[model samples]
Target: MLIPKLLWPLLEYEISTSSVESIEAIINTFTRKWLGFPPCQRDVAMYCRKAKLRLPLISIVEEYKCRKARLMTMLEDSDETAVRLFQSHLTINRKWKVCKAVEQEKKALK
Candidate 1:
C-alpha cells in the first residue's frame, strides 16, 4: 500500500483529472520509486506484470495477464503483499475494452 502521506495528494489528483492516464502516471512513478533500483530485468518484468494487473483499464490486459501468469508459475516463493495488492487493486469492473461488433463477431467465429 502507498503511504498515506504520499498517497493522499495523488488520490486527490485522481479525483480531479478523472482520467485513467493520470492515475497510471502516478502508478508508474510509484513503480519506478519502488522497483527501479538495482533489480534484474526479470524483476522489472514481474513488477510491470503485477502493475498491469492491479491497474485499471490497461489497454493490454490480456498481454499482462499472460505474462503475470507465467511469472506466477515460475515463482514458488512470492510476496504475499504484492499479490494481495495486485488482487485488491484490480479495477476491471470500472473499465472495458471497446471492440467493434464485427471484430467481436470474427473472434466468435474463430
Candidate 2:
C-alpha cells in the first residue's frame, strides 16, 4: 500500500524514457535483490490490486472537512473539553481507518 504511493511517481517519470523490457528488468532486479524472489506476473497484479485499494484523496479531504464542520456545530452547544476529546477521538478513528485500509490492501496482494 505505502510502497506503491511512493514509487508511482518515479515509475511514471521513468516510463517515458524506458522500454517495457527495461522497466520489467529494473523491477525484477529490485525484487530479486530486495525481496529475494524473481518478479512474476503476480507481483504486477499485486501492484494493480493495491492501486485499486486507494481512496481518492479529494474524497478523504472532503470527509475531514465534513467531520470538522460537525465538530464545530457540536462545540457550539457542548463543553469545550468534551468537544476537544471527541475531536481527538475522531482523529484516532481516522488513523485506524487508514491502517485498516492498508491492511486490507496487503491482504488483497496475497
Candidate 3:
C-alpha cells in the first residue's frame, strides 16, 4: 500500500538518489518486518535474490534513471521547437544528483 505511493513520485518527479535511498529503506524495513527477515541481513538481499531468480525485480534507482532518460529524449525530440532544458533554482542549498552520489560512492570505495 505505502510502497505504491512512494514509488509513484520516482516516475513523476526528479528526486535525489539519497531520497530514493530513503524510500528504499522505508520499503525494505516494511518488507523485512512482513517477511520475518533477520535484522542483520541486508534488505537488498531479498531484492537481489528475486532479481537473480529472474522474477524481474528492478530497483527504484534503475527505474528513475530510465524514466529520466526517456523523458529527456521525449523533450528533446518533441514537436515543440522551443523546448529547452529546465534550469534549476539558486535558492536550494544542496542539489543531490545521481552522478554526484555515484562519484562519492566511488571515492568511498577508494
List model 2 lDDT by residue over 1-110, tens digit each. 54345344533232222243354556456654675544454444323435755322222233333444454446545767766455333333422343344446558989
In the range 12-70, model 3's lDDT, one tens digit per residue, is 66566677777777767877788787889775676574355432345666666555555
What is the C-alpha lDDT profile of model 1 across 7-100, one tens digit per residue? 4453323222235445555655556567554433332343353564442323222333333334333332456656644432223324432223
- Cα misplacement distance, residue 48 of candidate 2 (Å): 21
lDDT, residue 99, model 1:
24
What TM value does model 1 have?
0.27
Give each model's clash number.
0, 0, 0
- List runs of model 2 lying over 4 Å from the truth: 1-58, 79-110
Q: Candidate 3: TM-score?
A: 0.59
Candidate order, lDDT descending: 3, 2, 1
Clashing pairs in 2: none
lDDT minimum window of 10 residues, candidate 2: 55-64
Task: Pick the lDDT winner.
Answer: 3
Error of 2 at 45 (Å): 22
